[model samples]
Target: MSLTTDLAQAKSRANIRAKARAKSGSETTPAGEASPSPRSRRRKHRERIYQWLFLVPAVIYMALFFGYPVVKNIVMSFQDYTTATFFTGEAPWVGLANYAKVLSSSLFSTSLVNTALFTLGSIAGQFVIGLALAIFFQRKFPLNGILRSLLLLPWLLPLIVSSAVWRWILDKDSGALNRFLGGLHIVDTGIPWLTSTSLALIAVVGVNIWIGIPFNLTILYGGLQEIPDELYEAGSLDGATGWKAFRHITWPMLRPVVSVVLVLGVVYTLKVLDIILGLTNGGPANSTQTIATQSYDLSFHEFKFGEGAALGNVLVVISLVFAVLYLRASRRSVDE
Candidate 1:
């Protein structure tokens, strides 16, 4: 009985010692509460510095290139400054006169119409041809990779070079296209492809479509490849075939990619200048003039800086509108 009572007393004493140690360990120290470890503090400081350092170059470039020019152009559009006046430091404020002139001009209307037609035609043609080619190439075939690479040749070539080649092929007397067509009795004589207004516009659009096809094809093919084969198999097991399969399975899967391509294609086609410049120079009567070409002619050729700025501003507005439309459409599609 005496031994058991001694053992219980010893156990109680051990528990008290352990509780005292745990309490002391839990107590916070002054130094520990005052500051965090050097490593963690240094890491946080380094992250902030790196964040600003990474953004610095981009901010500087935008201020110099995009911000300054936009401000200067806006200022210039309100001033009536000629070549002489530009150097004389005597530009008169013209308010809305430059804008009024541009809006009232026949050239502006014609160029707007031409630009619209070109943009729409090129987008339609490219989408059709590219989608067709992508569908055709989705299957396993011989020399498929080789053919795909060869198809990109036109797109890879410099725009000026492509324009020059097209010009030669469309030449009245000595062009290869004319010769070939004549041999086939397609035409009675060599037609003036570049000299005719309607034909010139059509030819420029056709060349743009041809050049754009490869890029669109590549993108569409990638999208097609991403679609699971299981979806098609399931579609086939149903009563779906041909167009029904594409409409229900392929199109829904490709909607996002198609939206992106359409937006980009519209923007690119609207801003096309090099091809038209090299091919026709907005001739044979200014029939192929687009906003980009018109801007060039106004600023450099006619020395109307204010008018050119207005035209550029208009183009910017158009692009923004399209971008907004695209975003809304994409959002609605996703919601659906």
Candidate 2:
């Protein structure tokens, strides 16, 4: 009886000691891991802060470079900012006056039409030719890699260089194009490609199309390469070959990439300035004058900084709408 009682007392004392120790010690995680110490937690937080320090420079750079300019442009759009304002620092508030003036101008209408034509022509020509070339290169040929690399030359050249080269090529007199045409006896007189009002915009669009071809080719080719051969083989079994195969298997699969390419092309084409500036300078009665070039002229030449900002914002709004569309397309692609 006494031994049994002593054993019970000993067990009770052990239980009491264990409970005391549990109360004094740190809590544990669900997996029975002891909680981290305060000092260790502080050290971990400090380490995380050190990791975030790497992004500080990028944040600052974006703020100073892109964010500040966009905000300043928006503010300037609402004020009568000009060369005079620059020196005197007295840009009077003008609300929507700048926008009303720019939008009502006949030049704005001409520029808007030109922008539409330039964008459409460039995108259409670039996409069609690029797709055709991409399909051709898909087949095996001698020096295929070399030729493909060389094809990128136009796109790889700097815009300024391309503009200068095209300027010489398109020069009505003593130009390579005119010389070639003369050799073929196509025309007795050289065609005024840049100097003529009717032809200058067309010529600008052609140059932009040429510059944009290789980019479309490269991207579309990559998209084509990603398509599974198994799909094509299966498609063939179903009597879908050649044109039919492309129409069904290839076209359906390539839609997402096509959407992305078209949107990006439109955005890029809208902002083109250097090529037009170098080739025509929006000359011959503002034939090649686009919103981009007009904005440049307004800000620098006419000293209408507020109007320039307003025009620039219009471009920005247009780009943002396309950007949203791109995001939705991208999301749909991901969902698929």
The model with the greatest TM-score is 2
Model 2 regions more than 4 Å off? 1-59
lDDT at position 213, candidate 1? 99
TM-score of each: 0.81, 0.83
Q: Tens digit of lDDT per residue, candidate 1, span 17-87?
A: 57875786688755764576899789868855765565566667778988999888888778785677677
Error of 2 at 286 (Å): 1.2
Which ranges of candidate 1 are over 4 A from the true structure?
1-53, 84-90, 329-336
Task: Please report the candidate that would top lDDT against the real structure.
Answer: 2
Candidate 2 accuracy as TM-score: 0.83
Task: Report per-prediction Cα RMSD to one decimal.
Answer: 16.4, 15.0
Model 2, 1-336: lDDT tens digits are 443454455556656757865876655434533677788789868755754464465567678988999999999999999788978999999999999999999999999999999999999999999998888898899999999999899988999999999999999998899999999999899999999999999999999999999999999998898899999999999999999998999989889989989999999999999999999999989989999999999998999999999999998998888889999999889768
